[model samples]
Target: MGFQKRPYEPTLFVKIGENGKMLIACLYVDDLIFMGNNKGMFSYFKRSMMNEFKMSDLGRIHYFLGLEVVQSNDGIFVSQKKYAREILNRFKMQHFNPTNIPVEFGLKLTKAGRGKKTDSTFYKQIVGSLMYLTSTILDIMYAISLVSGYMECPTAMHLLAAKRILRYLQETKDFRIFYEKGEKADLIGFTDCDYAEDQDSIKSTSGYVFMLGTGAVSWSSKKQTIVTLSSTEAEFVAATACAC
Candidate 1:
């Protein structure tokens, strides 16, 4: 009951203590998830919630939203393995031949293509689906973002490129993020940018990843807004974006 609502995250509430005791609760519509290191606090909070609201104790979390949660003595592992497979089946790519990589190395793509025009709506649907997968699949983020820019008039080549990501996913859908225990959880980050790689817009893509211990906690892959004059400028812009 003493939990304070987080200012930035409206759905999150926290109970902090000076003796290293803490509790956090998140409310998503009718769903609520709470976790803490103190058993006494957890017991008290569970009783209070049951008194005020009709709720079921689900015990340990096994799944949340579209994420699969697997816990062990080592730590926690999260992924969307089921969702990934569903994506492949939904697009009728469940049996498609797998690819080692999502995109070709150093491949330059533009709106101008000799391939026949494809269904823009279908193309956008693929992009949107892959975008959701990026929540647990960071490897495909850049490729998905690249194909997303051509949603207005996607050609056959653009569709092929988008499906290439699916083929890659077909083989790597079992990938999961593991947050192992007993490791020094240093917040490490890495960033990179390609100088004027986009042929149509001449814009550089900025990508960054921030990791905590064994798994990544923060990351992004986005196209820069401004056209930088040089590689140095592009790097500066990318670094600024990553920092912000």
Candidate 2:
């Protein structure tokens, strides 16, 4: 199809037809999805792909890569409700009481926290599941990242915090990230940091979320590599990371 690999996005390929029709394709392992402005060009491209490979058209994808997509008159929504429920059942928290926030305010997890050691295997599994949830559930990014730090040797306190995140998920399982379709394609990003948030390491936490108009396209929550003495410096470092 003479498509060129999209810069900065390795999985995406783009091609502009002589008729001014643009086609974009994204590949994830064996799954491929097509999007284009021209109907005729889109159909032709689909036919070409079918002839070249053994593929089935799922048509208006509802489930892909563990993310559930819902199409509506207003916009498209993505979620992971089924996965969230599975996590809850696996951890025996399916009927757990719901919580308003994923993480408690001023909560600081430490390596030297006083608690019994938890099963590393189960702790890692919970963290892994929550990490996947972060793909669509942006609100839990910070909590997931926080609990993930103790995957190697999680304690009872850490496990309790991880379960709180699950409780939060149970409360907002139906929430989805809506990507409304419109002409606007503006890209905006926000960055912030907490100075010396980590008690043990004395490292700051930096987080950023990028939005394509109203829908988030990318996001991250992690500790800074280097320690910053001032909040202004911490914020600057976070903003630089987002820009990069």
Candidate 3:
């Protein structure tokens, strides 16, 4: 009952009771997720909600926003197998051969690549869908973001690359991020960058991934704003960005 809205995350609310039990609730549109370490408090909170609102208790969170959660004695595993399959089929890449890697190593793409222009509308649709899929599928984040750079004027080569990501998704659709119970939830992050990887502008790309326990909670792959003269400088830029 003493729950207050979280300062940083707007939709999250938290409360600490006299017994030192902690409870949290996250609201997104009409959906709500409740989490707490105290079972008695959780039951009290659930009862209060049922008394005040017309809502259905879906039991434990198995699926949310396309993420499938599998609970076990080991811990929890989250994935998007259904969503990955849907997107692969939507883009007509379900039958394509899967690859071990989403993008070929040392592959560099540019806006000036010589190739036939692809259907802008269809290319954008595929890119957008793949971008959404990256929420639970971090392996394809870099590849998706790379191909997305050319969404404004995608070419045949760019489309092919995007489909390759879908193929990777098709192959690894069952991949899950396991959040082992009792594991330290300390936030750990890693950052790296390539010096002048973008061939067109010769600008570097910076990337970072933050994890809680063993599973990633946030990640990003973006182009650096200024030209970095050396790999050392590029790494510095990436580390600074991740620190932020």
What are the lDDT scores of the predictions, listed in order? 0.91, 0.88, 0.88
Using lDDT as the yardstick, the better of models 2 and 3 is: 2
* lDDT of each residue in 116-157, candidate 2, tens digit only: 998999999888888888889988888987888888888999
Off by over 4 Å in 1: none
Tell me how far candidate 2 lies from the true structure as C-alpha RMSD in angstroms. 1.5
TM-score of 2: 0.94
Instruction: List, residue by residue over 1-244, the lDDT tens digit for candidate 1.
Output: 6889999899999999669999999999999998888999999999999999999999999988888999999999999999889989989999999998999887777998549999998888889989998888888878987989899998888888999999999989999999998899999999999999999999999999999999998888989999999999999999998888
* Cα lDDT tens digits for candidate 3, 1-244: 7889988899999989877789999998989998988999888999998999988999999998888999999899989889888888787888888888999778888896559998989999988888888888887878876888898888888888888888788789889998889887999998988889888888898899999988998999989999998999999999999998
Instruction: Look at candidate 2 and tell me the lDDT of residue 191.
Output: 86
User: Residue 39, candidate 1: how far off, in angstroms?
Assistant: 1.3
TM-scores of the candidates in the order shown: 0.95, 0.94, 0.93
Candidate 1 backbone collisions, by pair: none
Model 1 earns a TM-score of: 0.95
Residue 237 in model 2: lDDT: 91
Q: Write the number of the candidate with greater lDDT, choosing between 1 and 2.
A: 1
Which scores better on TM-score, 2 or 3? 2
Arrange candidates by lDDT, descending: 1, 2, 3
